[model samples]
Target: MLDESLLDDPEALARADRRELLRGAAEAGARVRTAVRHATEAGIAELKPDGRPRAVLIAGPGLAATGVAELLGTLAGASCPTTRLTPTGVAPASGALRWELPGWAGPVDLLLIATPDGSEPGLELLVEQAYRRGCSVVAVAPAGTPIVESVQGTHGLFVPMATAPYEPTEPLAASAPGVLWALLTPLLVLLDRTGLVSAPPEALEKVADRLDSVAERCGPAIAPYSNPAKTLAAELAEALPVIWTEGTSAGPAGRRFTAALAELAGRPALTAELPEALAAHSVLLAGALAAGADPDDFFRDRVEEAQALHARVVLLRDRPAGGLTAAPAARELALSHDTAISELEPEEGGELETLAELIAVTDFAAVYLALASRA
Candidate 1:
């Protein structure tokens, strides 16, 4: 059970944030600036790429890497193809996971790597393979890791993953909040120069500014009634959230929310894109997870057990495709099944800024859930 009172108590929330999760969420904007600076120092901005690579191959070990690859792939769309190289194996080390380049990968391909942990031997070896294939490579990871040496030796560009003033000791905690920007910003800078994306430094500054504004609104000091993040945490305390995203930008943000819920809040969530989501998640809304499924649920002894979980539809909306929106139908479907809905519609902005806002608010909500929930 969650202590609702804790959501309004700034000091209590801080005390519960032993891993400094809240701090990390608040520092997202700062991390973006730091990352941009790192890219400049690493000469990412000065790259005079002969041209965009034939295809982009990205590889990494965990959630952060996959999220980066997905976001980059979405942004790169038709201009350049971005593929996440999944780990496969025959030549395996102690039966550990491995990554191998596809047969078609060659000199014309570009390999991008992003990881919060730079010590992965698999990733280091992947760099070697990319070098041997004559693929141009670029990576961002913590400074002084073995992967840095491997990347440098392979003649790949290495940008250090920016860190906060108080880096968390736990790896998952480290990856949850601010580190994503650190991993992503430098890559955005590089991609902008290569003409695959539109994230110039000024546009990136707008993203940072947008993030800071969200932090202010969603900060611990705010009360639940006025705070979107705290309100979301309270709503999700006993909910099995069925996150439905209605825009291209919302898709990545919705997926990120589920991952953050699991990683930071120790909660599992389900997400699907709009029209497909209506059919994919309809069963959940109509089944035992539905609000009206149990008439006697409310009369059950509150002292004996925690509240029963119910499906809650979290609608994340951004710009629509071809000016068409599926949100009205989604809301109607949820209402027809007697399910509660939580909607997050972004303010008007460029694609990167809007994406940053969706991510920031959801990130704060996850931190609130992490801090205020009882074990």
Candidate 2:
């Protein structure tokens, strides 16, 4: 019989899994760093700006671009001016940084391309232009995209874009500001600490303090026994085989959840949407449910829709009638019919109990082991 008691202490299970996942992530990051170091040493020398250029942010229709622009503006301090780039007109400036688009005369000190998925063709062109212009190019791609390869080939610098995970009411547009700020604030502080950018010590300290607070409050829930991050990662890894068959949102959530888990486990989480990372997991999970071997298939099928709604769906084996998990079969059917998926939980009742149950059955050890599998 399946040991149900393991589901009783989800946190403990997650913690045990997270340790391994975190270590694996660290190793992966180190490899990436080595590649970056080699690229920086051999390909393109660092661009040293004679003076700060008037930064111009090309406002694309994408939410992530707008968010990055706003973040840069805030962190660069009041001296830097930001102008919107449109199809019709260009802002009057001698030296300016254009984000994503490279339509400007004269020299650009820094060119940054920010995209949610890092799949923009325009970004490729912009990097080429930056190479031609001898300007510093920073491409902010979704984590795990071939950004490193692209940048390395282009002989440009690649900075992994980072964002905080927050459950907002709407799409990224609604919560971009806060998330961007959270990411940029820490980055700016780190830059200042390393002396890459000049800022007063007190000012830097304030930013660091704020970042610490944000990490404590909004960061992933972490513990030795049941780290939310590790548990999420393991869940994603196990579900990887059928991730794509699941809804896009669910896929991203799984990715993001796994990334978050990796970070909490003391590794560098990918700086892209969660769905991307968990794409494989979602497909596998969906396929597994389709196969119908697991008893939790009914609730598992609805995970994506529930995540999209930002509502937690718990599958309770024994509960009152007409509750959230009351009709698992119906929930699965409804989820199958829908286009989006949200967080799904298959278990008995009570919030704590549900969390425990999900954790108990999942192979936290396997998830941790997968992290080690990364080269």
Candidate 3:
């Protein structure tokens, strides 16, 4: 059970969050709002073109890279291909993209490097490589860091994120799902200027509005009975989560959601695209069901041991559109196997709003799960 009483008890909830994860999560909506101001002041309004860039590359370490890749990918959508580069192992000097550039048929026209803390050996090396290759670069990091200095007069642009009251001094990984908004807003604004993505003038307003709305709905002040995030956390407790999304628009958000589940809740989650997941996940679900309880066991044992093998399927979708969502089939499949299922779809809006809704909700759920586990 979720301990509904705890959701309304500030003292109990605070005790559950040893790392103040809830604090970071709660400020996410405000963080995005703050990011908009930073992005505008950074002068990303003026971007020098690289003459129809062949491809866009976003490289960073940890959540920074993932956020950029996913957010940029969603914004850029089909306009231009995007790739995210990450370090595999710890050979700082080797860099993550050092050996991977050869496969591209042509040079990367644009490369954005983000290191929330402003320093990552691998990311620095990647920045050097982009400079050497003459790619137009935009490096987002802290002010006065090596990354900001290294990109100083080169063909690169530096967008620095100053530490704000909304952002804790802790590492970006600990502040993620919240930090992502600031890290990604500038790139979205730049992409909008580049004519690659269509971000209307009210777009940021819509995003902020959605973020604020979700925050209100899922905030600590809300009771579990009325809070969607808390309810979802309760449903996911003591069960493995298999997450799949309806379309590519929500793909990056889904990936980020899973990452939050892992980081905040200390739970591993599996995520995949639709059509593919339907076939691949069926086998795993079948085996899990087969190994455990009978499908028709209405009076099965309620022993703790019996629940250990349980799993839940979470499907994320956009609420406005209704073309070919995977929820129906996926839900049916899970129910057939006697597995629990839950679905989350953000309120109707453009791609970004949908992304914000799903992410904000899942982000809160992850924090609540972390809090509930400790309680």
Candidate with maximal lDDT: 1
Poorest stretch of ten by lDDT in candidate 1: 88-97
Candidate 3 displacement at residue 360 in angstroms? 0.7
Considering TM-score, where higher is better, how would the candidates rank from best to worst?
Answer: 1, 3, 2
Backbone N/Cα/C clashes per model: 0, 40, 0
Whole-model lDDT per candidate:
0.89, 0.37, 0.72
**Candidate 2's TM-score:** 0.35
In order of lDDT, best first, we have: 1, 3, 2
The digit string of per-residue lDDT tens for model 3 on 83-170 reads 8875577443323333234345235478877667665555666667776777777877778877777777565777766345644444
Where does candidate 3 clash, by residue pair?
none
Runs off by more than 4 Å, candidate 1: 88-95, 172-175
In candidate 1, what are the lDDT values of residues 1-375, reduced to their tens digit? 788999989999888887878888899999999999999999988889998899988887667877888889888889998999887665433136578899999999999988787887888888999999999999999999988999999899999998877656554553488878989999999999999999999999999999999999999999899999999999999899899998878999999999989888889999999889999988889999999899998799999877789999999999999999889999999999889999998999999999999999999998888788852
Error of 3 at 190 (Å): 0.9
Candidate 1 whole-model C-alpha lDDT, 0 to 1: 0.89
Q: Give me the displacement of residue 229 in model 3, in angstroms.
A: 0.7
Q: Which regions of candidate 3 deviate over 4 angstroms?
A: 1-5, 48-51, 91-108, 166-175, 289-306, 319-322
